[model samples]
Target: MNGIRKALRDGLVPPPPSAEPVKHRDAGVWTIPNLFTLLRFLLIIPAVISIFYIDERPWLPLTLVAVFSLTDWVDGFLARLLDQYSAIGAKFDPLADRLGLGLVVIALAWEGLLPWWAIVIIATVDLFLLFFILLMDAHQAMRVNWIGKFRTALTMVGVVAVLAGPAFAQPVLSTIGVLCVEVGAFLHIITGVQYARLAWLGRRRFR
Candidate 1:
């Protein structure tokens, strides 16, 4: 029990010694995990172009979305697997997620596939959380609750389903897709309230 508590307090991996130089330690900007993050960002351009300009090429954009969304998981896994976690990657990963998710939501809303309210709610929550992070200086210690993670997973699943639905001309698929989005959005709102409560508690602690 004592060993488990110590491990939890100190983290599973030991920190590098102060006297020894760590490999690829130039502030962690040039690691494999960071590379995956950069790739995710670059994917956004092709995704946007496919959605806006290439109306006839639905598969292209859908594929990009699927790949881009999946890379969110990939980058995190690589970060932990390769021991390539870095402060920059930590921040960049979530930013990439927001950017990718935002782009998809905007495109879907503009195309009249999704309701504008969904976009507004998601954007508002994201901005509020961003502000809270800045206000609390909690970037390093910030962690997403399971509910938040589940919400993200549901959102991505819905987006992919919707994209696939129209590409294949399946009304049932589109219906299912919309249902997923609705459920995901509801969860998103709940998580947003949870986050706000946490932020309030954090503020009270500082006061």
Candidate 2:
């Protein structure tokens, strides 16, 4: 449990008192995990372009979405499997998530696959997390927060469901996906609060 906690600290959870400070990131920025993340990023523009052709070639964007979702898991899995974790992946992976989600959601909305409120909700959640990160000076810590994984996992699943639902003519899946996204937004706020409290305690005690 403690090891799991340490591994996911990505600047959100602070170390407990007397715990050794995390140091010397052992992985390179160019590791297989990071490259998977990079692939998601590199394909974003193309994905958006494909969305425009959804009526004609829905397969294109849907295929890309599937790939994006797969990489989301693959990158994290490879990070742990290959033991190639890096500060870059810790920080940049989430950044890419937010960025990719924002742009893709916007495109989806434009294509009438999603409503505008979904876009607002996602952006709001990202902003909420960012606000606390800045407010609490969270970057000094080395571990990634495991709590965010629940939120991210739900989100990734939600996104795929949201798109796949319509493509496959399954309204139920789309509804479930939307529900997951809404729940994820709630979790975002909850985890942001947890990060704030833990970060405050960390800085106060360390000081």
Candidate 3:
């Protein structure tokens, strides 16, 4: 035992602990939250198909949309719960949401459920934000604020309501849906302006 102790002390045997630091794996693009985001994207095709082509079966598309929207919340919750937040997921989540909402808006406009002016307003704001983000490469840099989140939630609710209204052939539902969409659109504009201001400040700070 003394000999072994001496050997260890003299470094004849390797030390028990390695000098290297243990690498803790961080969450990446391929996480549960990301999967949910992908699922939401996939649902978009079906949702569009149901809205435009599946005229007789509105429930099918509505169900797909509802599930897709719910996944948005689920993925965000899971990201926090599982500590699986990633830069890619952050960008991808909102991109998926905007894409989904854009498609719905376009479809509604095409079907005459929504006015063209509303589409223009939403599209213009989104495009402006997209360009600003691209110009600044601020995908990871720009954090999502509470107002932005609230706007998105409200937009989703409005879109769902509008879609359901026409599907059920209910005038009251359609009216309410239109009102919700208009309100959501207004909120979207406000958030867009706020984002633009933020982007401007961010740009100035970086320069």
- Against the reference, the lDDT scores of all candidates come to 0.72, 0.70, 0.71
Task: Give the winner by TM-score.
Answer: 3
Query: For residues 57-146, could you state the per-residue lDDT of candidate 1 as single tens digits?
Result: 768878999999888877766665566667677667777877778777778778777788888877777777666655553234235666
Root-mean-square deviation of candidate 3:
14.2
Q: What is the C-alpha RMSD of each candidate to the true structure, in Å?
A: 7.5, 5.1, 14.2
On lDDT, the leading prediction is 1
Q: TM-score for each prediction?
A: 0.77, 0.73, 0.78
Better of 1 and 3 by TM-score: 3
lDDT of 1: 0.72
| Alpha carbon lDDT at 101, candidate 2 | 73
Model 2 C-alpha lDDT per residue in residues 1-207, reported as the tens digit of each score: 655554455323444545765554657677998889999899888988888887777567878877887787678766755578776676667667767877777787787766677567777766665554444433343233565667777877887887777678788987898788778766767775665566567557757
lDDT of 3 by residue, 1-207 (tens): 664445333222222322332222457778998999999999887888777763678677668877888898788667656667776776667677777888878787887878878878888888877766655543343445666767777777777777777578766876776777787788889888987776677677768
Tell me how far candidate 1 lies from the true structure as C-alpha RMSD in angstroms.
Answer: 7.5
